[model samples]
Target: MEFLKLPKRTTGDRSYGLTSIADFGTPVGRLISILDDYSHIIDIAKMGIGSAYITPNIQQKIDLYKEYQIKPYCGGTLFEKCYQQNKITEYLAYLKKLGIEWIEVSNGTLDIPLEERLTIIERAKEDFHVIAEVGSKDCDLDMSISEWQEEIQIFLEAGCEYVITEGRDSGTSGIYEKSGQIKSELIDELIKGIDPKKIIFEAPTAKHQMFFINQIGPNVNLGNVKLDDVLTLEAQRNGLRSETFYLEEQNANYINQAPAH
Candidate 1:
């Protein structure tokens, strides 16, 4: 079946983007069907945490993701487990064997030293496209905006393709308050200091996604999105949904306006 032609929205590869999660519970057949319809709008398919281990025919799933041009990688928690077990090298090898090139390096759970994390990013870059995440997953952990800004710079300098602002799958940690409210003051500070394009804000909830899109513009890079929300989020991005429909109207008016006198 053919799809309707729509005005192209700026994708992260072209500008900024969305990274969706593919966990163990999602059936492969269902995922493939969704990809058939929406892969053009989906950028990344993160096999969240160690879901790869529990997923049936994991390699096939990875191949399907690759086939559709979706960058697929295990979540950073799996890397943390490998690191803690002193099997990071094995993890990298396994990822390569699966034909995966994109990887995430994060320290949300473990307190890996900053220098050590940078070294990991530098090393990982030799074999893979590294996506380094900043901010702790634990809500109790408090960090200053300057600290976040500094770490983001370090990750970027160390050659991470994208730096993820930690918002756990629940969207209640990292950049959000325990109640899922964004720490806007801190986000504002980070945005002022860093290039928003390089940072992927983890906005897993609808509210969080809307807030970031509204605050950072439609092209903001967002991560940790659920698989089902891919099209919904894209609709918001392109102003197809009610929440952002005003943006579509504004653009239409701009394009149709008469020349100024």
Candidate 2:
């Protein structure tokens, strides 16, 4: 069946345009079905946290993502656990064994020093496509906007492919308040100092997704999206959904026309 042609958005060099989380227990068959419809819009498939440890037939799942041209990687929380266990080397080797090439490097939960985090990014860059996350998972540990911007620069300088703003799968931490409201001022400050294209915002909720797309344009990179919302998020990006329908330039004429009383 022919699908409607949508406006093309720049996705850099990534095969798929959006990033979605595939947590533990995601049915491989179901995932494949979702991809059959929306694979063109998805780029990265993150096996959230330590899900890779308990997920059944993980290699099969990873293979499927690759077959569909989606980059698959273990979540940063798993990397933190490996770091805590002093199994960093083994973890890298294991990821290699699984044929994974992309990885997330983050210190959201564990307080890894900035220097050490940069070192990790530098080393990880040697083997994998490192996507470093910036921000603390602990709500109380908020950093100033300048500090956030500086850290993002450090991570990018350290050779991370992209810097992710931490918005846990719950959409209530890191860059967001407990109520799921984005710290727009902080984001605005960061954008002023750095290139927004190099950063992926973790917008797990519908509101967060729409806000980012509106603020940064349709090509804004987003992460931690739930499996079910992939298509909906794409709709928002392409101005096919109500929340963003007016975003389409072609709709300007209709929007300015008088309505019937």
Candidate 3:
């Protein structure tokens, strides 16, 4: 009966529908202890860049993440490192031993052949929930919409759950220009050939988050988010106090005010 208690809910009382936290091992045991308090809302917890390599305790943290219904996957950069060292099979085996059900396969740093990348994706799909990534970490390297489209298709056909468009950490590299602005026209063309649902943008900035939310809607998959920014990003998605929410409210008000016979 206690579980059946339903409080009065309202749109005004809600904001984000999904939130993901980045784990940096900042008192993670204490953090997971409090996760059940918000487990119903937090959707994921990415083991942030290379932090897993620093400690063996990560396996237990990952287990905790799953216990809270949060999918915890290694960073793409970690996969890139393993691929660079030609140790991907070893990496996959390690992930399995760690009880991880998800892994990110990316070629952000090293030049992994497209055929090889496809093979890696398929191999990862054999056991883990594979998320493939596109976009180079180097700013000088540019990927055309056509190329992005083909890569998306390749990953999707190979059973990848999502293809992350690399914005890198600073949101100034890859598909994003130096000014942190997204080339919407390029994104528009890329989306023409791929399902938006299978694409996730690495939008780590507020402006980037807002632009994507406004253009692609709140449900757009975003990545590389900092640990502390999840709540703020969720606020944007749910149209809480941000300009997007205000605009929606204004539009609703206008519609309600329109003279009706």
Candidate 4:
């Protein structure tokens, strides 16, 4: 059990180095089973898209997440839907009724003016931990890197607990390329302008997870992770998996590795 030293991870109800999972209406029984084993490593559970509004036993799922210390929240797409309908007031009330303490304020699909988005974040901070998501769901949305950084900076200034870089659930779009490749140049620039701890990169694939771990170390905050990949992600984070088995060495600049023969 004490064979190797792994990278330091933020554990036991932490803020940064977070792992957020997307719950696409997982059956209650299945969720319970997953939580029984991996809840300690999961920080947030999102009812993805607009599914939270229509899913049965939604309240039970939220309560289950809370019981395991996983903060449960409806996805930003649901917030976008509510904003589109001009029902944000009712939306907040609904979230509070269901006992969700976190809410993602995003306009990935719709165009919400910056001032209005910031205003919503400021108000929502009173009732929930507001996480604002940047980037458009439609890949064609023409947003420059500076614009992305500016928007994220504005969100943090407006007081978001975390600003999510959109990679979508499909692993294509936002921070990622059409081929599901990580945009290293863009990611590097974004992090240069933004604090890595306050930013959650949405990496839905094993490749994405691996890239982030190797590029930013194990303490990088990641989101949009599938429920099934929770343990795997945690494994990579701890350097227990092949993908990141040398992560601790890399973090130490390979200071401990034997020199070339």
RMSD of candidate 2 to the truth, in angstroms, is: 5.9
For 1-261, candidate 1 gives per-residue lDDT tens digits of 837443246643444555555554578889889889988888888888788867778899999988988889998888999989999889999999999999999999999888888887788899999999999989999889889999999888888888999989988888988888899998889888788878989988878887776677666778888888888888787667677666644544221122211
lDDT of 4 by residue, 67-91 (tens): 9999999999999999999999999
Q: Return the top candidate by lDDT.
A: 4
Global lDDT scores for all candidate models: 0.80, 0.80, 0.71, 0.87
lDDT of 4: 0.87
Ranking by TM-score: 4, 2, 1, 3
Per-prediction TM-score = 0.89, 0.90, 0.83, 0.94
Error of 1 at 232 (Å): 0.8
What's the residue-level lDDT of 77 in candidate 3?
77
Q: What is the lDDT of residue 151 in candidate 2?
A: 90
Better of 2 and 3 by lDDT: 2
Off by over 4 Å in 2: 1-7, 11-17, 250-261
Model 1, residue 69: C-alpha shift (Å): 0.6
Q: Which structure is stronger by TM-score: 3 or 4?
A: 4
Off by over 4 Å in 4: 252-261
For 43-114, candidate 2 gives per-residue lDDT tens digits of 888898788978879899989989888889999899999989988889899899999999888998999988
lDDT of 2 at 83: 87
Count of backbone collisions in candidate 3? 0
